[model samples]
Target: MFPAFAKYRQSFLIGLQSNLVYRMNFAVRGFFSLFHLAVVFILWGAVYSQNESIGGFSFGQTLTYFLVMLVMQFFVGAFNEDYQISEEIRSGLINQFILKPINYFSYRFSIFLAARLVTGALILIPLLVAVPLLKDYLTLPTEAWRFFLLAPAMMLSALIQFSIAYCFGMLTFWFLEIQGFVILSMAIESLLGGQMFPLDLLPAWIFNAAKFLPFYYQTYFPTAIITGRIEFAAAIQGFGIQLIWVLVLLAVNQLLWTRGLRRHTAVGG
Candidate 1:
């Protein structure tokens, strides 16, 4: 069992090393991300200009929000694994993965984490270079504990999202196709997950309701914690919400994996 995880870690490390060997690939990704940042800046800049304040967020505050959002985006936005399960199922690769002497979840998770490390580093360097100019607008949290607590909170979000996404991917066992559904989920999360705008800009009813949803904790709550936008009490409550969602997704993914594994009759099996 221990060696199984070790193998997964080895695979992940190999992935990082492989990516490093292909420096141009990382360069291309980083270049595209910079263009994306420019687009976000322009769009948000226009929105801020339209309104004196968008739901209590000033221009600088909103810009800072996007900046932090960009960082979180960099940390987690490498691959879309939603289609990976479907492809594996279609091609019968999943059967091999299951038969291997390893926990499939751990293997998949380690690969995800490893990819994030490489991509995050690639994204951070360029962004950090820009930080000196944007420092006036951005507010790093003053509370030492908040910074410490933020790491695990973000990790929880990453794991929860990966697990839920796997569950969605596992739906491939039942459905022949799931790309449309994946796109829909991505769209809804982007809109409501505080990626485009702060949740505070959303209606009061919607903002309150988001607490129960996983999307809020993904980008909004964690970014708020790091940016010092959330008060200490609210940060605690946000963490609670994030943990609840993590638990719920864990159970859901476990159930999905069990059921899907049983139903899985691979093409080449």
Candidate 2:
């Protein structure tokens, strides 16, 4: 067990180094994210001009929400592994994993985790620097305890999102052309994951329904926890929901991978 753990650690380090070598690409992404945040800032500013608050959030709070949401999205929205897995399946490159002693899921997850660490750091540098400049418009959680709790919530968010993406990638075993599914999954996630806007802005019924879905836990719940939108009791409940979803998704991933592997044949070179 120790040797296997060390091997996985080595893979993670290799992935970190590999991604760092392409730091310029992530730097470009980070730049584009700033532009995206600016556009969101302007748009939200326009919306708040005529109103004091919407969905119990003031303009400053809304701005703060988006800023934090942007960073959370970076960490939780690392889904590229799905596409990579799909492409490898199509190219019959997955055979390499079958011949190795490594657990394919763990191997891929290690790489994904490392890539997120590198890209997350690049993405966060600008946000961290901008925090002081945006201090006046920022609305942080009043209860400092929620801040401490947010780390675990966000980690769960990453794992849940990664599991969802892994399941989508597993579809490649059955359908070699699963790009459409990948795009569809991303579209759904963007819409329902609170990436586009806060779930609080939605109608009560819709918001209530969304809470039951995994998407809500991906972004909105964690943001709400840190922003003090959710009370302590409610935040605990939200964390419970997040944990349950992660377990459910883990089961789904395992089942799908097992079934998919049976159907998968590395036919192409």
Candidate 3:
């Protein structure tokens, strides 16, 4: 089994080396995150000044959500995967993967893991340094299970995010351009994934509807679970739904990959 995955291991090493070359970029983004966090605190702070709470999140809990979200985005973000895969498809670079025994998705996923690992580490430093300053406003989980369950939730979120992103990138095998799809997806995800605001804070109908989509499990559910924003029953239900979404998205990804490869090969890709 170890020998079978040697190639992916090599890919991971290469990805780490490549990402290291771009270390300054991650460092700069991490540095700027402090400023962004400051702005968010002030903005949310003002909002809570007028109200005791917004959607059951005290001002501190709200801050904690955004802070946790920023960190989560670093670790699970897959924005570049789509563009990279699309470029490979358009430039005929995907032929290399198809001609080889290696799987394109597996190779890309290895690199994705490396990229997130590096990016997350870099961004995490600044956040950690700033964390002490805001420790007062940050809320820890009251329930012991939440502390235990957070890791698995985050891991599931990573798969859900990557599967969806991989499918988006596979669209390039059919469409010459997928910018519209990516942009539209990003907008919907931002709103639905609790980037713009907590999904629970949305109108009841919208909140209920968004939960049916994969985006809900992405950022909000995992962060909410750790923050105690949800109850134990809800958390358990979310894990089940999260697992289902993973299976569903993986199936979709497999379907897209199979069909997309046939189309590409048919056209001499």
Candidate 4:
């Protein structure tokens, strides 16, 4: 596996270099995201002025959760990847993967991983600079053990999201236009993946249902772990559930890849 990864390693490096050239463009994009943060703070601040806590979080803790979520999104958010992958599939660029020794999924994953690193690094610049200003609102995890669990949870979240996006991208094999499908999927993810708000803020039944879905594992689980909203036992259980989702998504992606390739070969060629 190590020897095989050497090939994808080159892809990783190339992706990193290519992304580096556009650092300023990406940096500016990250800079503008602060405006969205501003709007959130104002809206939530108003809401909190009326009440001490919403969904068991004090105003400060709730804001901290959103701040942490912003950072988590920088790390694991999968956007444009579906479009990119679908474009490649539609344009027959994947023919090279079949012809070459490289695995298409591995190649794309390495590159996307590099992209996430570059994006996360760029976004952190402004965030770290703003740290002092926002210190009053942000809260760090209380226990060192939470940090330990956080690392793997973050990785699982990344894999879970990427696998789902990849599976959506691969659907290009069967459909001519996947925009509607991809958009619908994104709407669901944003609603359910704790992108809009912590799932704990939802009604009991809905929150409980989300726990069984892969969406919550994407953003909510890790953020909840860091925010101390979840107990140690719950965090450990979430870790296991997240890990299982990763495995399940991987299996599903493999199945999609197998069938997608067959469809592509028969229809495209």
lDDT by residue (1-269, candidate 4, tens digit) is: 99897999999999889878878987997898787778778999999999988987887888888888888887988857788899998888888788888988888889889989999998898797667777888777679888888888988898888898899998998998889998898889888988787789899999988998999988888888899889998888888888888999999999998899888863463
Better of 1 and 3 by TM-score: 3
lDDT of each: 0.76, 0.84, 0.87, 0.86
- Backbone clashes counted, model 3: 0
TM-score of each: 0.88, 0.94, 0.93, 0.94
Write candidate 1's Cα lDDT for 153-199 as tens digits. Answer: 78887876687678778889889989888888888888777876778
lDDT of 2 by residue, 203-239 (tens): 9999888889999988888888887677888888888
Compared with the true structure, what per-residue lDDT tens digits does model 3 show for residues 118-141? 998888789879889999988876
Model 4: how large is the Cα RMSD against the reference? 1.7
Candidate 4 colliding pairs = none
The stretch of ten residues in a row with the least summed lDDT in candidate 4 is 260-269
Clashes of 2: 0
Model 2, stretches more than 4 Å misplaced?
Answer: none
- State residue 211's C-alpha deviation in candidate 1, in Å: 1.1
Best by lDDT: 3
| Model 2 residue 260 lDDT score | 87
